[model samples]
Target: MKKSISNSLLLLSGIIILASCHSKKQLVKRQADSSAVRTDNAASAVKNKINAIKSKQVSFTTFSGKAKTKLNVNGNSNDVTMNIRIQKNQKIWVSITAVIGIEVARALITPDSILVINKLQSVYIKKPFSYIYTYASRQVNYKTVESLLVGNAIPELLNENGKLEPSNGNVVIDGQLQDLLYKLIIGPDLKVTSTDLSNQSAGQSLHIDNSAFVQADGRVIPSEIAFSSTVKNKTIQADLKYSKTEFDQPLDFPFSIPSRFSQVN
Candidate 1:
C-alpha cells in the first residue's frame, strides 16, 4: 500500500507541472495581444495629431530655448548644455557647452549643409548634417537634435513638409530601458513599452508621450517632455521648459571652410 501511495504522489506532481506550463503560455499570449492593441491605438492617435497640426495655415517665426543632452557609450559618459534657435525655413543655430569643461561648440545648419565650429579647438568642420552621425564621437542622434529644438522627433518635423516620407524604422530612445520606439513608417507612430526608471542613479529610462500642443504661432510642438535617461550609472533628469518662441527669421549661413585648418575626411 505504501509503494502505491508514492507512485500516486509522483503522478500528481507531473500533472501540476504541466498545468503550470500551460498557464504561463496563456499569460504570454494575453500579453502579446495587449501589446498589439496598444500599438494600434498609439498609431491612430499620432495620425490624427499630425493631420491637425498640418491643417493650420500660420507660419511660425522663430523659436529659441535651452537644451541639455547626456550620452553614454560603452560605459563612458558626457553631458552637454545647449542654446537652440530655429527659423521657419529650417535654418537652425545651436550653441553647445560641455558640462565638465564648459567648452563651447557652435553649429549652424541649413536645409543643405551643416557647419560646426569648435571653440575649444578653434576649428570648423562642414558636412551634410546627416553625416554627423557617422563621424562624431559619442554623438547624439539627429532625432535628439530635433527633440532639443522643438520637443518633437525629426520625422515629425519632416512630416510637416508633406514631401518628406516617413521611414520604416524605429529608434531606441534613451537606450534599451524604456523599450519605446517611434515607428516612422505605417503611420508615424510612437510606441512605448516598459523601461527601468527605479534606480535614478543608474540612469533612468526616457518616455516620450504623443500629446503635443501647437504654440502661439500655430506650429505643433511638444509642450511637456518627460526626459529620463541613464548615463554612466548616473541618474539625471530634467523638465525642460520652453517658451518665447519665434519662427521664420532669416539665417544667413556664415560658415566657410578655412584653408588653414587641416581637412578631415
Candidate 2:
C-alpha cells in the first residue's frame, strides 16, 4: 500500500503536462461561412483574447491546501488525503496520509531537483528534475506544474504558435507545438475550465477538467479537479476536491533524511 501511495504521489507531481488538445479538427479549423473572410491569425483581437485569459491566472506568494483525493493507478484505487504547499515559483511540498492520519509518504520538488521519502519502507529517492520528466512529458516544467495545481493555464499554450478561434462566451486557444497538439478552454469568468493534449503518433493523451469553482483566499479557483491520462496499457486517473485552502501564509518545509533510510535510483 505504501508503494502504491508513493507511486501515486510521485506521478501526481509528474503527470501535469502542457500537451492539451482534443483532435486536429477540434482545435485546428472549423467550418466557416463562404461569404466571411477567414483569418486564424492576422487579427489583433486574437492577441487580446489570449492575453485576457493569461491575466486570469492565480497570483500568490505562498499557498496551502488540503485535498481529499481519489486516485487510481494501474487499476488500483485508493482514497487518501493530500497536504499541499507551494511557494510561488520556488518549491512545492506534499504530504500523503491514510486513515488515522498516518503519513506514508512525503515529497519536495524544486526547479533543480526532486526528493521523496517513503516512511513505511525507510527508503528515499533523490534525482534531478529530468528523472520525473522522463516518465511524464518533457514539455512539463516547474512553472507548468505549479500553474496546473492551482487551475491556471499552462504558459506554453500562450506562445506565438497559439491560434485563437471564434467562440461563444468562453475563450478557446489551440495550436501545435512540435509533436504535441494543445488546446485550452477558459470559462466565462476567465478561469481555466478544461485542458486537452494529445500526440497521435506517440500514442499518448491527457485531459484535465475543472468541474466546479469557489472562492479560496479571496481568489476564485477550481474546487474540484479531475485528471485522466493513458499511454498504451498504463492508465492513471485522479479526482481532487479541495476541502480547505489558504494563501500567502507563513509556512515551513521540513525535510531531513534519516540515515537508516536507503536511497533508491
Candidate 3:
C-alpha cells in the first residue's frame, strides 16, 4: 500500500510540471502572434498615408508669398523681409529687403542657372545651378528647394523605395538618396512635418521643420518654416514666417543684373 501511494504522488507531480511548461509555451506563442498583428497593422497604415500624399499633388501654375525671414550664420543673425515668386518649374524669384524696406539683394533661380544681384555691394553672381550646392548639401536642387519652401516632400524621396515605421505618433519614411540618408516625418493628416538629411561621410546634416498650416486653394500650406544646416563644423539657421500667400495667380518674374556690377567668381 505504501509503494502504491508513493507511485501515485510521483505521477501527479510529473503531470503538473508538464502542464505548466505547456502553458508557458502557449503564452509565448500568443504574445508573438499579437506582436506580428500589430506590426502588420502599422505597416498598412504607413502604406495608406504614402498613397494619400501621392494622390494629392498641389497643382498650380504660379505661387507667391511674403514673409519675414531671420537668418543666422555662424552666430551672426539678420532679420529681413522676403518676397518670393515662383512660376512652376521655370523660375523662382526672391527679393530680400532690409528694415527700412529697401531691397538689398535679389536672386533668380532657374533650372540650369542661378543669378543674384547685390545692390549693397554692387556685385552679381552668375553660375550654374550646381553652384548653390556649395552652400548647401550636395542633394540640394531646384525641386528640393521649392519643396522645402512649400512644405512638400522631395520627388526623389517620395519616389524612392523607403522603409516606413511609426514613431512618436508620426509616420517616418527613411531612405537613401545620393549617398545621403534621409528621414521624412509625416503627420497624421498626411502632410510632411519635417525632413532630415545626413551625409555621414562628410559629417553634414540638414533639418527642416514646417508648421502653422493654413488652407489655400484647396490645399494646405505651411505658414512657418525653420531650416538648420551643419556642414564642415559650421552651422546656419533660417526661420521664415509667411504673412501672406497666394497661388494660381498670373505673376511676373523680372530679373536683370545691373550692367555696372562686377561679377563675382
- Alpha carbon lDDT of each predicted model: 0.38, 0.74, 0.64
How well does candidate 3 match the true structure in TM-score terms?
A: 0.80
Local error of candidate 1 at residue 84 (angstroms) = 1.0
lDDT-based ranking, best first? 2, 3, 1
Q: Which ten residues in a row have the lowest lDDT in candidate 1?
A: 16-25
Tens-digit per-residue lDDT, 1-265, candidate 3: 2222222212211111000000011111011111121213455655555666665445677888887777665676767677888888888887777778888777777778877677777777777877655545577667765666677777678743688777765667888877789998876656777889888887777788877666765667666678777767666676777777778899888888777889976
List, residue by residue over 130-177, the lDDT tens digit for candidate 1. Answer: 553232212234433443345334333323222223234321222212
The per-prediction tally of clashing pairs is: 9, 7, 0
Report the alpha-carbon TM-score of model 1 versus the true structure. Answer: 0.44
- Candidate 1 stretches with Cα past 4 Å from truth are 1-50, 56-59, 100-103, 129-148, 152-220, 223-260
lDDT of candidate 2 at residue 201, scale 0 to 100: 71
Quote each prediction's TM-score. 0.44, 0.87, 0.80
Residue pairs of candidate 2 with colliding backbone atoms: 19-197, 20-182, 20-183, 20-196, 20-197, 21-196, 21-197
After superposing candidate 3 on the true structure, give the runs of residues whose Cα lies further than 4 Å from its correct spot: 1-48
Q: Which scores higher on TM-score, 1 or 2?
A: 2
| Cα shift from native, residue 90, model 1 (Å) | 4.1
